[model samples]
Target: MMPASSATLHVVATPIGNLGDLSPRAQEVLRTVAAICAEDTRHTGQLLSQFGIATPLLALHDHNEEAIAGRLVARLLAGESLALVSDAGTPLVSDPGFRLVRAARAAGVRVSPVPGACAAIAALSVAGLPSDRFVFEGFLPAKAAARRERLQRLAGETGTLVFYESSHRIADSLADMVQAFGAARPAVVARELTKLFETVLDGDLEALLAAVQADGNQRKGEFVVMVQGAGDDEDAKVAEGRRLYARLNEHLPPSTAAKLAADLSGAPRKALYGG
Candidate 1:
């Protein structure tokens, strides 16, 4: 059993873009820790050097985190406090360091968070969508078919949907969203948050897609795409009714399918009967 003095693991949040966002306490933790576990040592090194923090860095990223977590936990049990940081934003929030933090807690080492900049939260703050309840979907699947499939599954979600996306996929993803969620669905695309060229775009999915396609610069930064939730119960029922009517009409007569779908989905028959 480790003694009561087991070292702590500080999960630190670094700046997503602006260097000024790095809190004073985070700098102190980076300075005093025995070593900082970073997703990318070189990127973290550049950040530390800016503030003159000379703490040695140990590489701990997706590819190597599982293999090294045990070793890091052993060090914690040996009374050497360590800090874990991602290249940017909060650690383990779509970033690495999950394994190390889990291992440290499992081994009776205390784990604490030093929260600061998180792109998802930062974007949400500026997004005029509902903040009362929301979901953070880290990043959509990279492939087109898979991405569309995922969006289809979330079409009826009532809480605001938040997703992080790379610059290259922003346009395609928004297009897919318009297809899956409808052209008139409200959404916001927050790009390069906290950085000099930051832009937050607001409109229906169709308009947003058009803007991204028309402006090359709009598609050129890290993105936090937020979508307003599916509307009231009647709206959801109409959507479900239409989906069901399409499948049912293949076998049954159009009128019969519309009646059945409207009954099953709690939507008005007139809405599904026409098409």
Candidate 2:
């Protein structure tokens, strides 16, 4: 434990899949920190054992982060330098530790980042899609209806769309994406990233759905799905407008739904009404 004035919180990134991807700095930080707060103690304990880093492990996950964050911050304030890590990849990227990090920062304790392999960044690097400006919608709703609603809201986004999905729902998610974004929208599915059996599948949304359905292996691992942004073409706008109109028509009159969809999708009112 360091002095109170010198104590800090190190937010370290662990390997997403390939253990070799863990950086020396991350390993060093984990080895030296008074204790490492992990999303899963048993899982992280194995990782620590692989590197022979015997620092203490503390369980800090979504279920308990809020309740324990204050206590962790108090320990930092009392001069115990600590580290935070998730089960995989960076902390707080669709993982736990948001409360702990915020608590430490608000307590005036220093918080540092040790960045490494992130599935989103890794997938983006090779997806060949626009990455300069993109949105990371980590995991969509698990249910089909809620998931479809979310996709519909993002239908008009002009930047790349990235998502993390589980193996169980990958097929259904891709199907909903096809319905919302159109079958021809270009997309890529990076599965089992950084690990053996890693595969990156790319094509239109329809093709992606078909591929995943045809190949059972494609739906068996963690996935990072990237979709091309909505284009500025007239056809694209009109297509988006039709999707919006259909959804809005459920809650509003046809004329009102068409007007609102036209306004939101930037398609002509006549186009929405098929004039």
Candidate 3:
């Protein structure tokens, strides 16, 4: 049983893929939270069914967070303990629990975290990419042009770059990644981690793209793409920039080289061929 003093909001993390990763403490909180604000009740229901947790769940997804935020706030203020759980992984890491979390905090309610499995961290675990400093670009823009623009902006960032891509757009996303991040940039596509049919393909963008293209089997499952950061070596950096310039110049003007080069180099736009 959770402590009486712990009658507070708990942001719990459930299993990312494998149910076994769910922590005892997290489960304890889950079983005892007076109520739970789930991104999707049906989805959370399946999870709760595993542990026989019968706590009532409130659906508080993107579309409904604002509508339900006030009631949730009032409940928490009345000293009713609640747990917030996403369909999977840590709550609020790309989920809709932020408003409630913020409201709880604003109301001077104690908020505790029951941390556990996180998809980004799960993918990063075996991605073989640098873990030092990474950025999570959660689920790219659905539109190709917007997605490509976003990809182009992060091409040569000097830290591991992580992106969540869906199966339907994975091919197109990978293709844009090749254009921006480059064909030779080292990357890893981790999917279904800790679940059946788990696959991790680590290779340069071109090879990974080709591998994904060649096999119908490789195209399934949720994905996390981890790209290695830019390396040192002034000339090598320029070469990477030249590659991007080559692609851009084909469909753009010479003046466009600076923008393309900047995207492929961590260097300043002005420094890259002096703008």
Give the range of the ten consecutive residues with the poorest summed lDDT in model 1: 1-10
**Which should have the higher lDDT, number 1 or number 2?**
2
Whole-model lDDT, model 2: 0.91
List the global CA lDDT of all models: 0.90, 0.91, 0.82
Error of 2 at 60 (Å): 0.4
Cα error of candidate 2 at position 71, Å: 0.8
Candidate 3 whole-model C-alpha lDDT, 0 to 1: 0.82
Per-residue CA lDDT of model 1 for 1-275, tens digit only, reads 65344688999999989999999999999999999999999999999999999999999999999999989888888899999999899999999988888888888898999989999999999999999999999899999878966887777787899999998999999999987677898999999999999999999999999999999999897999999988899777776776677668889999999999899989899977765
- Report, for all candidates in order, the number of backbone clashes: 0, 0, 0
Candidate 3 structure quality by residue, lDDT tens digits, 1-275: 33323359999998878999988898888888789999889999998999999999888899988888889878877778999999888888877788888877777778888888888998898888899999998899999988977876676577888988888888889998887766888999998778899999999999999999999878898888998876656534654565566457668776677686667664455544543
Sort every candidate by TM-score, greatest first: 2, 1, 3
Please, what is the TM-score per model? 0.90, 0.92, 0.86
Most lDDT-accurate candidate: 2
Error of 2 at 264 (Å): 6.1
Candidate 2 lDDT tens digits, 124-174:
999999898999999999888889888988887889999999999999999
Give me candidate 3's TM-score against the actual structure. Answer: 0.86
